[model samples]
Target chain A: MRRLTDVGALREAYDLVIVGAGPAGMAAAVEAAGQDRAVLVLDENPGPGGQIYRAIGTAPLRDPRVLGAAYWEGAALADAFAAAEVDYLPGATVWHLDDALEIGVSAGARSAVLPARRVILATGALERPMPLRGWTLPGVMSVGAGQALLKAQGIAPTGRVVLAGCGPLLWLYAAQCIAAGAAPSLILETTPRANWRGALRHLPAFLATPYARKGLALMARVRRHLRVVPHVAALAIDAEDGALRVTWAEGTAFTADHVLLHQGVVPTLNLARAAGCAIAWDEGNACFAPVTDAWGTASLPGIAVAGDGAGIAGAEAAALRGRLTALEALRALGVLDEAGRDARAAPHRAALARWSRGRAFLDALYRPAPHFCAAPPDAMACRCEEVTGAALRDAARMGATGPNQLKAFLRCGMGPCQGRMCGPTITETIAQERGIHPREVGYMRLRTPAKPITLGEFAALRKTEADRRAVERR
Target chain B: MFRRLPEPPARRIGFSLDGVAVQGAEGDTVAAALLALGRTACRETAVSGAPRGPYCMMGVCFDCLVVIDGLGNRQGCLVPLREGMVVETQHGRRDAAR
Candidate 1:
C-alpha cells in the first residue's frame, strides 16, 4: 500500500483518470493501461476495496466462501493495477470535476489537480440510513460502519450488538460479527424469510458461484448463535442504564449494548451529478442512479460511470463493468479495433448477465418495507428541518403532492445530509397523503457541489473560475 | 428471555414533550428518553393517523421526528436533551391548519 502524500503536485497527464480504486475503478485502471494508455486511479481510502472488499485486517476468516471471494478478487485487482503500471493515488478524495476533464482532489491536508482525456467514476455506494428515534445514541451504527470498524480497526462496536435491518448485508455482517466473537444478541431482519422464495428463483445463478453457497452456509451457522427475527422491524430504541432498550413491531423487546442498522445501499452519485451526468430514479433501490450505457459510458462524450456510481451491483458485477468500460473507452479513443472490443467485452457481458440475476434477486428480497414511510404525525419525517409526518400530510392535503412543494413549505430536503436519507420517505409520505404513487412525485433537483465543501475550497474555486472567465472575455 | 432492567439513578432533567412533563437523562436525546418512557405514539399520521415511533436510531430514518423548542419538526434522535427542552408532538405535515 503506497500512500502518496502530494499527488496533485506530481502531475503528468494520464489517458484516463479513474476516481475511486475499488473493484470497478481498479479493473478499469488495469484494462485501460493495458492498452498502453496512461491510467491513474484516485481513491479516498488508504487501500482499495471501497467498502465491500474492505481490508480484512486479520487473516482471511476460516470460511472463505462468504466475503473471502470478494477479498481475493480485490487482492487480484490490486495486483493487476501494480502489473499494469497504473499510477495510483491513494487517500485522495476527488472533490471537483470540470467539463474540461479537470479534476480537483484532496489528500488529507494537501490538494492537487489532475487533468485527463477521459474520466471514469466508480465511487460506489453508501449504506442508506433509516433514521428512527434513539438512533443517535453512541451504541447505534450502520451495519457497513460496524463491519468497517471490525475490518479496519479490529474492534467490535460492542460485544452484544443487535443486528437489525433488511438485505443480504445484514446476514453477511451478522456472520462476520459472530465469527469475530462479538456475536450479536439478536438479528432483527425487516425482510421476511418468504422473500427468499423469490431469491430461490435465481438459484441457477447462485449455484454457479461456490463462494455464494459458502456464504449461505456461514449465515446458517451464525443463525444458531443469534436469534433470527424475520419480518420484524425495530420500532424504537431507548438507552437505559448504558444499554439499548429496543422494541420491534411484533411486540418483542430486547436489550443490547449496541445496534447495527442496515437498509441496503444507495448509489454514490455525487460525483456523477457534479459532472453533469443525467440521473434516473431507480425505484427498486429507492434512489437515483446515473444513466449509463451498457459499456458504462455516461451521457457525456468523454466521461463514463461504472460500478455502484452507475448502479448498485456487488463486486463481481462492478469488476465486469470496469473491464467492459475500459474496452468501450478504448474503442472511443480509437485505440481498439471492432474485433478487439468485441473479444474483450463478450465474456464480460455473459458474466454481467449472471451477476445481475443475483443482484436483482437480492434487490427484490431486500426492498424496503411498505410501512417504512408511514410516519405518524408526531414522528419526524425530515431530520434536517424536523418536519413531522403531520406537517408533510397537511401539505399534501393542501395540494402539495411533490417533494419540491413540500420542501418549499417545510424545508425537508434542505439540510446538511442533503436528503439522501429522508428524500424517499418524504416523497412517499407526500404520495400517500395525496393518494398518488411515489413515481408521480418529482425527484429532488441536484446542484453542483453535491457534498458539503469547505468555505476555503469554494472561495478558491470561485476565484479561479472568475479569473478564467475574465481571461476568456479578454 | 431478557428482563427489562430498572432505570438507572442518573441525574434526570425534566422537560415538556407536547405539554407533557417528561423526565430524561441530561445527555439523552429527546427521542431516546421519550422511547424509554414508553411514549411510542410520538405523533399521528397526516393522512391515516397511524401511530409512529423511532425507527432508525441514527439520523437517517427520519422516523423519530418531534417539534423541539417551537420548531415544528426536528429529528429527535439527533437533538440532545437539555434541562428544560420544550418538545411538541408533531401531528401532521407542518402546513396543516390546526
Candidate 2:
C-alpha cells in the first residue's frame, strides 16, 4: 500500500477524508474510492486494520486456531483496500478539525490541513473504565492492551495469567488465549447475575438473529472449556512478595504474574466531539454517542460517522454501516441519484439491523459494573495526572459541574494521552454525583493541536507561496 | 508467556534499546521488539516515577512512550523498528529533563 508521508503530497482538499481505517473506515474507503471519488483514508496505525483486525495486512495468520476466523476475515478487506484507488495515509495523526471540515494532520514531523468536501469518522471504540484498588500495579492492565500485543506482534502474556472483568471480549480473548496455547488459569466475570432477566428479554430476538446466535455458540464453547467465575463484585490487585494477588468480593484470591482486565468498550469520540457533531447519551450503551441517521449521516451536512464510534455495533455491523455511509455520502456528493443510493444502501441497512439484534442482551448482560464505572475513592481515576476518585468527586461536589470547568480545578484530563483513559469514568462519576445524565455532564471541550505536537514540528510545517495565494484569494 | 507460532515473522532486523544491541523482525514495532526481549518497562511516570510499559499496543495508551532516534515521547508500539535505530527509555514527559 502506498502511504502518503508528505502532508502536501496530494492537495489542500479532497472529495472525502475518512478519519479511520478500521472495518468501518476500510469499507467506506473501498466503496467510495471504487465509485471514483477522490478519497483519502488516514489512520495513526501502520496498517488498515484497527484494533480488532490489527496486523491482518502484514500477513494472514494461517492458524485460525489462534486468533479465530473473525480475526483472519479482516484480510479480505485489507486486500480490497490495497487494490482500491483511494489514497491511504498510514502513520498520519490528525490532531484537529475545524468547523469548516478542515483536518490538521501530523505525518511524522510535518503538519498540514486537508479540507474535505465530506468527512467520515470511523474512529472506533475504547475499553470501558475499569479502575479499581491496586489496579495500577505493574502486572495489571486492560485485556484490550494484552490483546493488542497478541494481535500486533503475537506476544502472549506469560506465566500465571488471569483474565478478569465482564464483556464479550473477555470470553473471546480467554478462548483465543487458550487456542493460542497460553491459556489463562482463571477467568473472573464481573457481570451481575441479575442481568440475566434483562438479557432474556432480548433472547427471542437474539436466537433468531444470525450474528447473535454465533456469539451465543461461541460463549457456550468458551464456558465449557475455560474455568469462569461469575458475579464478582469487589476486586483488588496487590503485589504480595513478588507475584500480583487478585482478590474478589467472595474472599477469593488468585495470584498471577499478569492480570488482564476487560469490562466493555465505548466509542472513541475525539474527532466527532471536536467536529461539533451533535451527541446524545445512549443509556443502553452507557456513553454519549454521536447522533446519526440510518445511513450514518450525522447532523452536519458534510460529516458522517459509522460503526462503533457512532455507537457500539461490533465488527460485522460496522462494515455494513460503513457501506451504507458511503452510499449516503456518494448520493450527497451527487455520485448517485436518490434511487441509486437507496437501492445500494438497502441491503447494508438490513444487514445492520441483523447485526444489531443481539446488542440489547449483550449490553444488558455486560454493562460495566457500577463500581467499575464510578471507580472507588481510592482508585486512580486519571492515570495521567494521577488524580484519584475522591479528588474528582470533591471537584464535582464543589460545583465543578462540567468536565471543562473540572479540568481547571484539577488536571484530570490534561495529559499526554488526552482524556482517552479517564474521560469515561470522570463523566460517569460527575453524572452520578449531580443526579444527571452523562450528556448533561458533557465531555471535555476540545481544542486545536488535539494530539500533542512539538513546537519544532509546528515551525517546520510545509508552506508554499501557492498555498498562501490560494488562502489570500479566499 | 507470548511466543510466535510456527510461522516466523517475514523479516528480521537489528536495533538498539538503551544502547544495547537487540534484533527484531522487520514488521516488529519497537514496543513488540522490546517485549520480545523481555524489556517491559519502557519508561517511568513523570510524577510518581513508577515503571510503565506498553499497556495498549494499538497507540491508545501512552504508557509505551520512548525516545526513538532523536524524537522523544514517540509511541513505542506505533513506531516500527529499523536497522541501527537508537531507542532510549523515556524518562517522563518530554518537557521534563531526561
Candidate 3:
C-alpha cells in the first residue's frame, strides 16, 4: 500500500474508490486489491481504523488488555490492508460523492475531483445525539469521545467522573476507564425498565450469540467496580461551582468533573444521502440507513453502502459486509462472474449470519428512551446553530413541514456540522409534533461540499465551463 | 478535565495555547493535547458565545473549532499537534481578513 500525501498525488481515476478507512474500508481494499483492481482509499483520520478500531496501529497504550481483545483484533486487518496493493491517503476527506462516481476530495489544503468505476461507502456510524439539558457544555462530551481520547492519546478524565445513558458502549468505556485508573464516580443507566419485556422475545438468540457472555461479563465487572443507578427515567446536567452537576430521578445528582454520555450509534448518512441513494427509516435501529440489497448494493449502480453506514452492525459484521461488497464490485466490474462471487462470499455470509444473531435483542434492549431521542422544548437540539427543540416545534407548527423547510424557517440543519448533530432529533421532533412517523418527516437534503472547504482549495481545483459559467459575472 | 496516564514517555512538542506555551506529546491531536492540559472550552460558539469544547474527537461535531497558526475555524481534533504551533481560542465567527 502506498500512502498518497496530497491531492496532486492521486491518480485521475481508479477502478474502485472506498471512502472511510475503518474495518469495512480496509477489508474491502484487501479483497479488491487481491483481485488486481486499482483501488484508492480516502480517510479523514491521520491513520486507519475508523472509529471502532481507531488508532489501532498507533495506540499509545502499551498493555493490550487495556483496550481488550475486540480492539486488538483490528491490527490483523490493518496489517492485511497494509500489505495489499492499494493507494491509501490519510487526512483526506471526501466532501462530495455523486451517482456518476465523481468524488471531490481535499487533502493538505487542496481539493481534487476523481472519477471511479465503483464506490463503496464504509463511512461508519456516529454516536446518537442525546440532547438533554446542558449537553453542549464544555466538560460534557460523548462517551465515544472519552474512549477516543484514551485509545489515541492514553488520557482519561482525572477528577470525579460520571458515565450516563444506555447501550453496551457505555459499559465498555467504563471498563476501559477503570483499566486506565480513571474509574468513573457513577454510572446512571437510562435503559427503560419496560424495554426488558420488549427484548425478552429475542433472548434465546442473545444467549446463543457470543456477545451475550462477553456483554454480561463486562456489565458485571462495571457494576462491581462502580456506583450504579438503574432504571433512571430522567437526567440533566448543569454547571455549578465551576463543575458539572448531573441530575436525575427525584433531584438526585452527582457533582462531577466530567460527564460522558452515550446511548447508541447510528449510521452516518450524509455522504450516502448526498450520493442520492434511496434511504428508509429503520424502525429497529431508529435511524435512517441507506437502502441496500444483500450484497450491499445500493439503489444506484456502481455505488455500494457497506459496514454500519448501511446499518448499525458491529465491527466484525462490517468487515464481512465489506468483503461481500467487494465481491459485488468485482462482479460488476467484470473481474469475477456471479457464481465465482457467490462462491467466494459463502464463508463471509455464514459468519455475518452468526455475528448478527443477537442484534435485535440489543436493539430492543438499548433503544434510547423517547425523551432522550426527542429533545424536550427547553433543551437545545442543534448545538452548532443553538436551535432549541421549542424553536423546531414552533417552526413545525408554523408551516414548516419537513427538515428542509425547517432549515429555511429556522436554520436548524444549516450549521458547520451540517445537521449531523441535529438531523435525527429534528426528524423525530417534527414527527411527534405533527403526529406522523419520522419517515414522513424525512432527513435534510444534503448537497455537495458536504464538509467545510476553504475558498482557496476551491479555487485551486481545475475548472470546467459549467463552473466558469456559473461563477462568471454576465 | 482530563489527565494523561503514566506511559512510556514520547517526545514532547511545545506549542502555545492563546500565547501560553504548553507541552504535548508527539502524535497527539490538538484537542487531546488541550484536554490533557485541562484546558477545556477551546472556543465559544459562533451562535451564542457559550463555552464549548471538543464533543466528538472523531470530527463529527464542530464544537472543537479553534484557530491554529492564524487559520480560523479549524477543527482541533482533526489537526495534529505540531511543534511551535500557535493555537488560539476562536471568539465568535471567523475573521473575514483571516
Candidate 4:
C-alpha cells in the first residue's frame, strides 16, 4: 500500500487520509495502520520528509552533520512509514477538502477526488513572512529557504552572505551553514532586548529541557565564526547597483550577495482554514492556528489537525501529537475503545509534555518585532499581488476593515499564493491601522483548491453527472 | 546566488533555461539548479514585472514560478529538473499559448 505511483492509482476512499508526510503525518499513519485501518498519506514534496527534514531520504549531502543530528532522525520515521501498511503518495498535492470528507488531489498533471472516513492535517509550518523593502529582490530569501537549499540539494550561499532576524532557528541554520563551509559573514538579530525580562520567568522550566543546552551550544558555535548583531531596531533590504544592500541599526548597511531572513515559523493554515476549521490567534506564538482539542479534533466532526498545523510545537511534539490524534480517531471509528485509546496515549502524552517543555520561553523570547510584523507603508505587504502596506492601510481607512473586504478593494490576498504569504501580515497591518487586535481583524477567507492547480488539472477531475449538469449551459 | 558543496556525486542532468542549455545535478529542483547555475532572478512578477527569485524554496511562495515544457506558472522550487526539459523565465502573466 506504500508509494502510490500516480493520482490515477488511488482508491476511491479510505478509512483515513492524512495530508502531509512530515513527522506528524508519518507517525499518525504508522499508529493507525498498525491497528489494521485503511490509511493513506499525501505529501506535496518530492519525498516523505517535509520542510523540517527536507530530503531526509534522498538528501544529496552525504555527511549527516551538514543538516544536524535532529534532521537525520527523520530517517527512522521515514523508514517506519515505509514499513507501515499505509498508502504513501509523494508529489501529490491535495488542493481541496470539504466537510463531507472528500479530498481533491493533483498529481503528475492530473487530478482525483477521494473520500475518507477521517482526515488528519499535518500540513506543518511555513516561515513567517518578513515584508521588508526589497524582500522580493533576487538575492533575498528566508533562512528556512536557505536551509532547505542546503539540505535538499547540497547547495550553500555563495559570496558575502548575511543572516538576519530572530529565533533559535536562525542560529541553528547559521551553525549548519558554518558546518557546510559557507559561514555567513554577519547576523542581524531582531529579538527585542526587553524580551529577556519576559522570557526569564520561564527559565527554570527551560533549563530542564534539551533545547536550552542545544540552543546555547549552537549559538556559541555560530558566534565564533560570524559577526552577531543583537537588538536590531530596524531592517531593510534594497537592490543597489546590482547587489543587495541590507540596512539596520541607524543607517549602518552592508552590501551582500545574499540576504537570508527569518523571524520564526508559523503553522501552515490555508488547508485547515479553507476546510472550515475555526482558527484563533495564538498570542504566545504571534500567529493564527486551527482550534483543536487535546486529541487534535477541529470544529468539524471528521477532521483532525495534528503537528504544527494545530499549533507551533516542534517536530518531537508533533510526532507525539500525531500518535495521540490517531488514537482519538481510532476510538471514534470503533477500532479502539475509549479505555484502549487512553491507555495507548498515556506514554505519548507524557513524552509530548516533556518535548513541549519551555516552549513558552522560546515563544516569548523569539516573538517577532512588531515593526517587522506590520512593516512600514512603503514595504511590500503582498508579494504575489504587489500590494504595499500603505495600500492595505488606505483600504482599511476607507472602510475595508476585514481581510475579505480588503481582497475586494485591493486584491491583497487574491494572488496565486492565496493569502498564505500575506495573510498574517495583512491581518496585522489592518489591525495596526484600525487600532484593534489581530483576532478582531481576523484572517483572509479562504476557499478550496487551496494551492493553485492549472485549469488542465481541474479538467482531469472525475466529475459526476450532477456536477456536469450544475455547470452545463442550457 | 549559491554554490555547490564539494561532495554528493550527483549525476548531471541537462535542461534549457530560457532556451539556453544548462546542466545541473540529478537531484536538484529547478530552482536549485537555477541558483546553482548562478542565475539569480527567475521570473518577473505578474503584477508589476519586478524581477524575483526563489524566496521560500518551499512551495509556499510563488516568486519562483517558471514555465516548464509549455506549462506556465509551474513552481520551480517544487518540480525536479529533468534531462532536456524546457525551462523558461516566466515573464508577467503566463502566455496562454506555449
Show pairs that collide, candidate 3.
none
True lDDT of residue A450, candidate 3: 82
DockQ of each: 0.04, 0.60, 0.87, 0.86
Q: At residue A129, give the lDDT of candidate 3.
A: 94
Q: Hey, what RMSD does candidate 3 come out at?
A: 1.5
Tell me the docking grade of candidate 3.
Answer: high
In model 1, what is the error at residue B54, expressed in angstroms?
A: 18
**1 against 2, candidate with superior TM-score:** 2
Give me the runs in candidate 3 sitting further than 4 Å from their true place.
A464-474, B94-98
Candidate 2 clashes between residue pairs 3 or more apart in a chain or in different chains: A156-B2, A158-B1
TM match of model 1 to true structure: 0.75
- The lDDT per prediction is 0.69, 0.81, 0.91, 0.90
Candidate 3 per-residue C-alpha lDDT over A269-332 given as tens digits, one digit per residue, 9 for 90 to 100: 9988888999999989988999999999999889998999999989999999999999999999
Residues B1-98, model 2: lDDT tens digits: 35554465657788888888888876788988887777767888886777777766777768888989978889988887889999998885553763
Per-residue lDDT tens digits for candidate 4, residues B1-98, read 68889994799998889889889998899999999999888898987878899999989999889989988889999898899999999988654333
Question: Where does candidate 2 stray beyond 4 Å?
Answer: A463-474, B93-95
lDDT of 1 by residue, A1-474 (tens): 233556544555878888887788888877888567777788766566667766533322434543445555566776776677677777566767867887877654455566788888988887765656665554566787656544433334444668888877788778766666556788887886676776677666666766567767877887788788778854677778967888886667888877877878877766777777888878667667888887888887788998887888888889889888888888877899889998989989998887776566667678776555545565567754567778888988987778777778888877645676576677677766767776777566554544444555555442456667977855
TM-score of each: 0.75, 0.94, 0.98, 0.98
Off by over 4 Å in 1: A1-3, A10-13, A56-69, A110-114, A193-212, A283-286, A373-391, A461-474, B1-98
lDDT of 2 by residue, A1-474 (tens): 456866767666788888889999999988887676788999988888988888885642457778888888888988888888888888888888767988888886778877898888888998876888777776677898878777776777888888889988988888777777777788888998788877888877777776676677777777777688888888888889978899986668988888888889998877777777888889899888889987788877789998899999899889888888888889878899999999887878777777788679788888876777876788888887888889998988899988888789988878887888888888888988788877788778756666888888876766678866977855
